[model samples]
Target chain A: MAGVAEFTKFPSESLKVGKGFKLAEVDPDTTPGYPGNKADGEALLEELDDKLAELQEKLFAESKFGGTKRVLLILQGMDTAGKGGIVKHVLGAMDPQGVQFKSFKAPTPEERAYDFLWRIEREVPGAGMLGVFDRSHYEDVLIHRVHRWADPKEIERRYKAINEFEARQVAVGTKVIKVMLHISNDEQKERLLARLDNPAKHWKYNTEDLKQRAFWDDYMAAYQAAFDATNTDHAPWYVVPASKKWYARIAVQQLLLEGLGEFDLEWPKAEFDVEAERRLVERS
Target chain B: MAGVAEFTKFPSESLKVGKGFKLAEVDPDTTPGYPGNKADGEALLEELDDKLAELQEKLFAESKFGGTKRVLLILQGMDTAGKGGIVKHVLGAMDPQGVQFKSFKAPTPEERAYDFLWRIEREVPGAGMLGVFDRSHYEDVLIHRVHRWADPKEIERRYKAINEFEARQVAVGTKVIKVMLHISNDEQKERLLARLDNPAKHWKYNTEDLKQRAFWDDYMAAYQAAFDATNTDHAPWYVVPASKKWYARIAVQQLLLEGLGEFDLEWPKAEFDVEAERRLVERS
Candidate 1:
């Protein structure tokens, strides 16, 4: 939040957090984007943020009042991996009116009664808009698998359900982009301790993170398993090394830009003739 | 992740994310910690991270193999508030063997069969361990209120339930720390758009964020209301301005340290005489 930073293209393949992708192989210190100083990178990020905002505005305008297709960004990461920074600096650029951000917390009593995707379905960005899931149905597989919350059979079933669900989204024109923000255990400790040392951040620290930290290996394996099971071309999972906050932030921004660009989104044509509208304005 | 940073004490009063709090009031860019460049801040963060790691180790050691009391830190915030950051940095420093982190995603079919807190109770940090809830039952009142998922009476009822739940935790020797990572609307935009620009980050961008962004005012009001309704002396809510990633990270770490400090946690006394045990081990 201090300032946006510029980012360069990210090596998505190197950072994928799933099968064939070992979390241990990624270095949190590596900056995949602009290899500039923090200040310059941040400044560039601000500039890029503005540019992205314009694109999102157009994307949203097209989707909503403009009659364009919609976009959905699914951010997945362990606790404190900077998914939030991406949201604040990248997605934040879009006009709030046109975007939909859902931070999926624990499901409620009613949500539990239905399939996991049911709630996700209710919140998918409609036509001509972009939708963001801070955490998504993927949790049903990731955390569930790590913790063995469900039997292997059930977990297997949900993975299939997820693939089918996403295929459905793509069919309906929801550009489903999934990114796993990958951070190292060392980096994770640094981030968590910052909060422990600062009183103002007390509310942000969860003792459970320490508890879950216990399962880092399990979670990593789980993520790898989930990615292997669900990383379809229609919804391929890109793993981003997240140890470097700036790199992760800008890399994600760039990723989003590319996704939207593929849509060939345009400012919706004016509702009326430009010449006539201009003449009326001139008269007024 | 690159380099850790040094941090100063944070202002808890100013950062409380609840009632009488204006999101705009706090500048996200403020680094109450070390006011140096990003590099220095990160360095100090790393130094603090190691120390906190040691402390958490002691805390956990006293509980698990050591036998100590329990700690719970609950984090609640709007999307992109950096809860994840605190989790990685501060809590990550702790021994993963003893930490239990539960990110409460949307409820599952089985979870919905009971009250909101049903699942929460099942996940509380056990004796001598640390438990973290990425998002707790607070969502029952938060998102529910913003979208009118529940009536006013129901919202009020849930608030009461949360207070009671925390009170019970206190009775059971659980140190419940609640935090809210607050960011300005402008900061949020920068983040969201960054996601849009980066194809790699498209997954992090949720169109739903924009829809939720549309209801910023409503969510803000709802947050303030919830804070008033549920924030208690025993489990008070601290709002940290997260625009400054370092400041927020350090603040939460400090808060957790203080919480753990109060416990007088010590390496649990050995069950048997150390010298005798050592002699037996030597014999073996």
Candidate 2:
């Protein structure tokens, strides 16, 4: 906690969405509260790594004992917006055992047969674990709205369902951090071109991405509408300017650090009689 | 693949168990084929990091396309023999998304009702993923034998069941690397004492570990019996020297490297027309 103050300048509060916040107005290239360049941002991330790992271990310890607190980081964005990058660079700093990661693809026929949130509810991180959702239930709204896969009336009902669902998560001690990696249209085009140019990166290129890019504006409008309905103090949305990958990595790491720091995490007391156990171990 | 030859001295072939291998013959303090001190071993691990990460991502990419190959690393040892350490220092180097890890504990009533492999079969890693088991079905034989919880006749049946189960996994494209983190009684004592001294580590200490310690000789014999019964070329067992933590880490890392490198993993060819997709992205 000693060196954590340096990152307080770009507190999660600055990136949080409030009433009437417009997604179109956010500059995808802006580094927001971070004043440093790429090198400096990377250095800060390296410094924050130990703190994040320590807190995560403590949270894991708490869960094994009597603590019920856990975290779920939901990443929502268009393809090539750096969701996978953040998973590798930011959350990757913690031990794999402490992190529960799930990447949602197209739902199976069985999943579609249930309520939209049914599959999502099953993947929630248990007490003391850090759960990460690469593409989450938000897709049901974001992609569904953009493609008109569901009627407008049904889509409207989903926003309220999402809010209530998230509130219940908060009530159960899960600190949900929902993030939209905001990258410009031009940035995405550049990324896609870079993927196409490298033979090694060909596996990452999906033709569906082009179809999604065609409806970028529609997706943005859907995002804003969903934000207006679902953004609450219990589980607020953070729009990370992801054009500079370094800044987004550090920002997400800091947000998680701040979330874990809120809990007064101390080691649990020994459950058994220490002296008796000590004598037994000494003799053995 | 260039510098990988440097580690050929400790190729997994050297550690693989054959008929009549004895657990007591292994010196937990020895570094086996690793011709290096602690600092040298640590440095080598750092150098191997990028190579391991690259191979893992290729495996993941292959899974998404059409590869069925996968790996499962099983770790078994007396308490405090560095199973968790190997996971943090070695498997932690790969992308967390590509590595699927599960730590088995005492089975619940639900788990006990089915055949022993019921829960284990459910957790096997899918295509192109690296699966790790902190403790596994081997426990059914090891602890059950030491405790006499299962009669001798029942215990004999489980060894054949485990071999058949693993052979099936190998036939279906899983390269199972089973390892026993061999640590001495002195090392276990020191580690247990260290845990008792640190409040933060108290949760990891269990009265059961001490109870299990009282049966060290019995447990060793039980392990040897298991090795004699179930060791097969399809799923080989390696005895990793656990006293020197750095040596164990590097050895396990090398074992996994060789496992993944056998696949001839080239970047997956583009599934769609690359030039056409490039043009579509450019115009979008």
Best by DockQ: 2
Least lDDT summed over 10 consecutive residues: which range in candidate 1 chain A? Answer: A275-284
Using TM-score as the measure, the top candidate is 2
Docking class of 2: medium
Cα-based lDDT for every prediction = 0.72, 0.89
For model 1, give the interface RMSD. Answer: 14.5
Residue A211 lDDT (model 2) = 86
Per-prediction DockQ scores? 0.03, 0.75
Instruction: Give the per-residue lDDT of model 1 (tens digit) for A1-284.
Output: 34544344454443444446555666667776466776666676777766676677667556545354778889988889987677756765555445666778778999999989999999898776778889999999888888888899999999999999999989988778898888887777777766555543444455666667778889989887887788888887878778878777767777777787777866554343434433332332
Interface-residue RMSD per candidate?
A: 14.5, 1.1
